[model samples]
Target: MFSLYALAQQAPSIDLIISNCKVINMADGSITQGQSVAIKNGKIIDVHSDKYIKNKYQAAQYIQAEGRYVMPGLWDMHMHFGGGDSTLHENKNFLALYLAHGVTSIRDMAADISKSVVKWRDEINNDQLTGPRIFTSGPKLEGYKPIWKGVLQVGTPEEVESALDSLQKLNVDFVKITENTLKPDIYLYALKAVKARGLRSSAHIPSSLTLNEVIDAGLNSVEHLGYAYNAGIPKAATASKASQFNAEYAKQQYRYMANHHVFITPTLLGSYIISHLDEDSHTNDAYLKYIGRGIKNTYSWRVDRAKNISAEASKQRHENYDNVSKILPLLQSEGVKIMAGTDAGYLNSFVYPGIGIHQELALMVKAGLSPLQALQASVVNSPAFLGLTEYGSVAKDKRADLILLDQNPIENIEATQKIHSVIVKGVVFDRRQLDKFLKDVADQNVSGL
Candidate 1:
């Protein structure tokens, strides 16, 4: 048997070690103090008491966390990358914005730039690019002559199958079907077909169908909260030909959703922006400094439409937003898993990509979720949405996608904004480096469309 010193020296070396920290246990909203987390080859190898790690292990690099809070990096579940080639470089710059703000992963809903987005996703995964881990839906499935560009238009079951076949070839993480004139019956067919092919499916529920109707047809996640709000109104079943939205009925529907394991991305921040556009013009939003001219141009369509609405229409928009936003707490109370998404990206006015997720968390708390619950919506719920078991928490053997905050986020969700450091794939970026990422993006000067 070797001496203690010799045994300690024989231990295998790791790449990085972070000691003197408070690790947030996302699983139960608890905090483990005085901890040290170890990483090797881009995965967490050990997370133990600080003294234990400091005395027993060695690494190529060591970061003194200095009692800061560590938690899993955030996920932005809904965002788009589009605007054709003119904005390609500008759009690609959004990646740096995400990392600077502690967003380690994102779910890119399909846009016109499917092929390029796919390549970006691959490159990011292979460590060839600097960006969040991207899981894209490729080109969304829609009907012929759909308003949105870069979609697989399918009018029949055969067409739907062919589109899915193409998506399969692309090895897309999941499938996204929209309501842009896609026949309802065929939409249901596509959902079933996607399930049969062993794929997860999310959709923009059409007004003609009740929330319950779509859930029964194998829809895994609802993209936005507007449709669910519509389903909860009294006489919804009779007037809109969908289910009712009353509390008792809502309880039943939520129970059904929990049993079925369907997820919801309220994307309340986007709705808030839409409802209050008339009140807050966002002309001076400092975040605009980072948005490209081409992407800023995309905002005009929505803004112009919002500007043209009458006072009464604007009030109704506000009322609609209030009603929809209120449903967020109800979903949480009923055991329905919520994924925090910003609905951020091109064409969604004022919803910036990087910082939008923080806004989403704040809104969730305002809508009645605790800070822990709100954090869960992004860090915990998002991984489950993708059926990925390796991420969403700070634990041994987990991917080293995490953020170190100067303040405790559990005390206030806004503390997340005080990012002290970020670790993506075991690569550490301290405060100075994070600011450099932001500065690099702003230097693009992509504004002034």
Candidate 2:
């Protein structure tokens, strides 16, 4: 004997509900106050006024946002996870570091451990692993007998086709091409071919060609600011040849980048770390405790290279870093999309996985991007660059990858580093849990130096 009115009034069921928060809209940095967000099965089902959420829905779990600032989780667009077979476990530990720092997604630019990385990517997606969502370029493309390990070496058009065929079989998220022994023509050929196959591409623009040439050939993103900066130099049309520093040519190149809509990842922190190597030896960085021996050993070659340089050479290196960083604000003014990546991994010195992103945002701010713009580089621009439509904003029907900050990041970018909690795939990791994650990573075993 059920009342008809009662039978008709069943509340909607949701997996989790977050209440009493100010949601930051990355779309334009607006704040929707006193909102409640309902999530079901990892996707945000609805966002509404708190009263509507309380009246119409029931959830298995409730997280009180307590007037905190909630926005999409950070994304590190360029990082790596490889140090040959011996460092596999060591590299895997980086996942915990990333999550503890409120970074919920990472783009693994190719490394020597593609097989292990691809497996981990799937596990994370299927809920079998505890880590960020991984988007990887499976074993990058290289030229014949290239120096980099785990690359598909191609010397001719036929070889390029076969290499792309292999990448398709591996089901990579995108293709990464480097200039290490790769010929300029074949690099262009690979870009065009990858595009023809309907695949997205990222690459180290060959110094032999103008930046515009690669953009014309279908390169979606440039991996470093140095390359973009090189393009901005007058007649910098080619890296191998010397040309006058033409300010007009540089303006044209930047204008061209704006017109073509090319994406650029400055990876300022890593470059800055190297540029300042003369002053900061980084031998006593506290973050080094989390890095394993094998990975730390990988950092030696670059460190040695920096140390061996003469005083004049070191001065030039600092000048190069300063000059290249100047392009950041210019790119912003030109409407070029800039992605924030730390380049924090093997062979890159002192750039830790988790906390390095915050440093990157700070550097971007120092380079003339506003705090909102710096945050956008990570939360909004990274996803947009990769075309990952499921993320990049806090909205209804979006994936529940978010961060809750004690202070509004819009007001101060450093506030992002003060994370209160993180929600990954609708699962909440409160501050205590985040701290425990750091401890667990710290406690993992690594070999002695």
Candidate 3:
């Protein structure tokens, strides 16, 4: 038998230990109770029974989870940061808001402030700043006179080549292409080029081209559900018709997506909010206080446009949301990877950052997903889609980005919002500190700094 001195010498010293927690295994939705996690150098060094870990290892800091649920920190796969130069400071404040809401990572799907976003991403990675881990597409690719601002306009194949070169130089996480003003042919060409370079590409499918064509051309992901909905209908069929929900067509489309490994970020929460804006103006929402005036002003454009919509059109919007949301379950059933993204940020009225991921999970459950499945979308599927091997679970050898909740989220998705503490890169922020983060953002917003 080994001596106690030898065993003690073998035990590793760790930076932090979270004991007596129930670890939620995102991979299979199982819960391991009375577990302890040992973290060192921002990675989980060990995870085992609380008694075993407490007896073996020593930690510099300890958090008695007291039987709370511990799971991976949330990832918002599709969000933005842009309201032009005037709202740059406001956008910066969103970082704290994300941490306050237990979001450990975010994917910025292109915006006007590409340079600033890149700097912030680097700073956060280097631990020079406090914010969620950022993976930005830099500036998205568009066409001549695109509807949106701050895009790389590429009309010809040569211009597309130039755009890709620029994006590669900037070292963007992925390539984002929008179809607002881009020609259908160029869109396909850009997708092919991005594929040839071995870079993942996400985009809006042009109405002129079928989803199959885009996927076959090497499109990695579809940003919104509308495109997937459109794919389920015949090209000649009117998309506005209630008859658009063809089960056979949808099954075939979803099956193709699964086979090809094309991920989909439904972003259902934003659609739900906009669809029901007439019923709840959200003027008195407590979350609004944290949003800067400049960013809030950007909300008016969409709000004004919604006010002009006729009652019949408003009803149609509600119907459209319901119809599209129903397919979320179908997508999951068919083995399609559905990533949870809130589409939260500037220009998207009232879809607040940070807390938006929790709202998105709840909406996913409402749309027929199990709470565990919805949690997987944020913590599991997101990292898988991004090929991040270090994240997405509460286990040894994984990144120590986690959330401690008073209740199990698998029991009720809303429990995710009941965060007791957040740990990013092995750094813990208790409830009090998280609340302070929110308060500071609110104070900054009020001061317009």
Instruction: Write one digit per residue (lDDT tens) for candidate 3, span 1-449.
Output: 56887887787888999999999988777899999999999999999999899888989999999999999999999999998988888899989999999999999999899989999999999999999999999999998998788899999999999999999988899999999999999999999999999899888889889888999999999999888888888767765545966878889989999999999999998899899887888889999999999889989988998867888988998998999898899999999999999999998999999889999999999999999899989989898887888888888899999999999888899999999999999999999999999999988878878
Off by over 4 Å in 3: 1-10, 238-240
Q: What are the lDDT scores of the predictions, listed in order?
A: 0.89, 0.88, 0.92
**Which scores greater on lDDT, model 2 or model 3?**
3
Best lDDT goes to which candidate? Answer: 3
Looking at candidate 1, the ten consecutive residues that score lowest on lDDT are: 235-244
Q: In TM-score terms, which candidate is top?
A: 3
Local error of candidate 3 at 183, Å? 0.1
**How does candidate 3 fare on TM-score?**
0.97
Q: Which residue pairs come into collision in candidate 3? A: none
Query: Judged by TM-score relative to the true structure, which candidate is superior, 1 or 3?
Result: 3
| Candidate 3 global lDDT | 0.92
RMSD of each: 2.2, 2.6, 1.6
